[model samples]
Target: MKLVGKTAIVTGASKGIGYAIADHLMTHGADVVITARNEAELATAAKQLTEAHTADKTKAIPVAADVSLAADITRLFERAVEELGPIAILVNNAGNSTLDLVENLPETDFDAVVGTHLKGTYLGTKAAINHMKATGTPGVVVNLGSVETFGTTRGNAHYSAAKAGIDKFTEVTALEAGRHGIRINAVAPGAVETPMGQDATTPEFTAAWHRTFSVERMGRPADIAKAVVFLASDYAEWITGITLLVDGGTHLRGLPDYADFLLPTTN
Candidate 1:
């Protein structure tokens, strides 16, 4: 449970589950590199973590970069190592969202979401592995996948496809990295109450979510964060290539009917 003397990198860490992961790592005695596309948010998040966890013996490094770009990914890892030392943990959480019918889906939308989630995760894992191999340090990579990987996500075909790709990528990559003492896994969350989740939680969405999750409420970012920490910690030393769904049993019941919820009620 203790990550003392470890250095980690968490992308998309300015808010939501990524921010929680960075904060949790800092709490467990790990120096962290927090990256996001928004420079202002990244700065603020880094400052907040540093300020709140002053006596935890943790340091926060903020780097603003679009992980979809190879150059930015390169600079991200380089700067992370320079600032926090060799990275032992990596959480690939950078993502984008767009929903449209297949007939109306644009190539740009597909590229944006796929590039950020799939490509970003791949590049980050590749770059980190090079350093981990050189140092002979066993590393862990926790990919932020989604429950859409298994269920149908109407209007978000690109996102669903990208998450499905991550599931397979995690397995194949873990097999290769296992020889080098590296572990890679994924945490596929359900309807988390983040900015993204809030935007998606229309009356139609919330009711559908409730039907799927017996828990009565939508998942929280910290729920996913706790799972990420366990998968990244030594507690899961023998675990790899598994995608744990943190969606409060949504995949068990499948996507629920939203037609009733979408209909306006007249009181």
Candidate 2:
């Protein structure tokens, strides 16, 4: 119960990596506010979380909002303070991606991908930092990054760009917020078996990808979740501004050829 009295807000927590982060936070005795664009899914996640953690008296509040919108981000923080307490942690894990070559990708697609990943992280971090500063709380912010940021993966130019931005953003924000006693960092996952990951690649691709990992297995959402929990905990009091790669040492080997599986093969 490292986070017994702390309250957290996790964006895009309806499912996948986001959901796993919330679960782990609650496991450590934090009251969590989970947000996503899908109302039904968010509610379901909240119910499951509440039921699962009833013994710990940890509450999970679900708010339906699009993190890319500033208005929604404001409301999310407000709700967290109103319903739970001062926000001690913020996880900017909401993201969406469309695979396509740079030239083939549409402008709107680029905007959506970048907006949700990069812009959403910015908005959520800004709100969390402001709230923490005002409340005199030394909170932590964990932004979601990707191993792709450090390597090339064709058909994911936009995704890689946004994640790379997040890496730098986390560092700069950590520098700015550190003086205020707030810590900001990022977790970069590689080929996690989430719905998004599965949708982006096939079994064949996953098999080949796993073989490249020193761990000899694909990542699980829980693996990333555990890393987030560690960074958010007091154990990492001196850690900030770094992008922690929780990719089972996959970064050491570089990313797989996603284009071979995602893009159409022309004979």
Candidate 3:
């Protein structure tokens, strides 16, 4: 129970990587306020989390909100404070993407992708830092980035740009918040099996991904979740402003051509 008294707010926690991060935080004895756009899914996740950790007295409160909206973000933080006291951790894990070449991608699509990944990070981090500073709490913020920022395949230009911006945003925010006893960092994950990534889990794609990964296996949500716990815990008290790649060394080889797998005839 490294975080027995701490409270965390995890955006996009209704499922996938976000859900895993919230679960791991609760495992380590932190109260978590999980948010997602889907109210039903968020409630379900909260129930499961609460039931799983009843022995530890960990609370998983679900708030339905769109992370890309500043008003919603503000309400999320406010709810957390009201229900669980001051926030000690914030995970900006909400994301969205549409597959299309830059030439064909729509402006609204670009904005939507960038807004959720980049703008959401900014808004959530800003709110968390302000709350922490006011409460005299040395909190931590972890932004969910992606290996696409470093090695991206085609049709992911918008995602790459947004994640790359997150990398820099983490650094700049850390520099600014460090003096106030706040630490900010990012975690970049490679291909992970999740509902959002179901389209990429075909046999051919799985084989290619396994061959390309140095670990010879796909990443699990728990893998990334464990890393987040480490960074959020006191073990990393001195760490800040770095993008930790939990991609199973996928960057060392290269990202598999997602288009090749999704659109076999396009090539």
Candidate 4:
């Protein structure tokens, strides 16, 4: 019960990495509010969480709201505060992807991904900070970033840009929030196996994942969730303004020169 009595709000918690993070926090004794755009899914997740943590220690609430919408974001925060008390931790995990070449990308695609990844993080952090500052809670904000911030993907320019923005934002927020005893950090994951990961599981994606990753297989959402718990815990009380890449060594491998490999070789 490392997080006993702590209150946390995890956006995009209907499933995948977000859900996993919320589960981890709840297991460790945090009262969690799980937010997502899908009402049914969120409700189901919240029920499961409550059942799993039914020892009278942790609690979970389901909130349905689109993170990209300002109104929805506001409502989420307000409802979270009402249910869980002043939040001590926030997991800004809601995001979407726009995978395509820069020229082929639609305006809507850019808007959606950026709105969800960058703007959503901005809004959640802003709302949480206001409450934290007022309550003098010295909270923690964990932004769900991506490894694309470090490197580029040929077909995912927009997603990469938004993620890169998150990287910079995380650092700036951490530096500024430190004085208030708040800790801000970014978790940049690569090739994690989740709904989003499965969506990218074409042959092209498989090839790319294989070439860039040193690990035998794609990463699990649990991998990222564990890191989040650490950062949110007093274990990493001194850590801030950093982007931890839970990418199974993909970044360390660096960007591979795939041009040569793309060419057909006569067998």
| lDDT of the structure predicted as candidate 4 | 0.85
After superposition, candidate 3 runs with Cα above 4 Å error = 265-267
Each prediction's Cα RMSD? 3.0, 1.1, 1.2, 3.3
- Candidate 1 TM-score over all chains jointly: 0.95
The lDDT of each candidate is: 0.88, 0.92, 0.91, 0.85
Of the two candidates 2 and 3, the one with more favorable TM-score, higher being better, is 2
User: In candidate 3, what are the lDDT values of residues 127-157, reduced to their tens digit?
Assistant: 9999999999999999989998878698788
> Which sections of candidate 2 miss by over 4 Å?
none
User: Using alpha carbons, what is the TM-score of model 4?
Assistant: 0.92
The residue-by-residue lDDT of candidate 1 on 117-181, one tens digit each, is 99999999998888899988899999989988878745778888999999999999999999999
Which candidate has the top score in TM-score?
2
The window of 10 residues in a row where model 4 has the poorest summed lDDT is 258-267
Clashing residue pairs found in predicted model 2: none
Off by over 4 Å in 1: 256-267
Better of 1 and 3 by TM-score: 3
Q: On residues 61-120, what C-alpha lDDT tens digit does candidate 2 reach at each position?
A: 999999999999988888888999899999999999998888788999999999999999
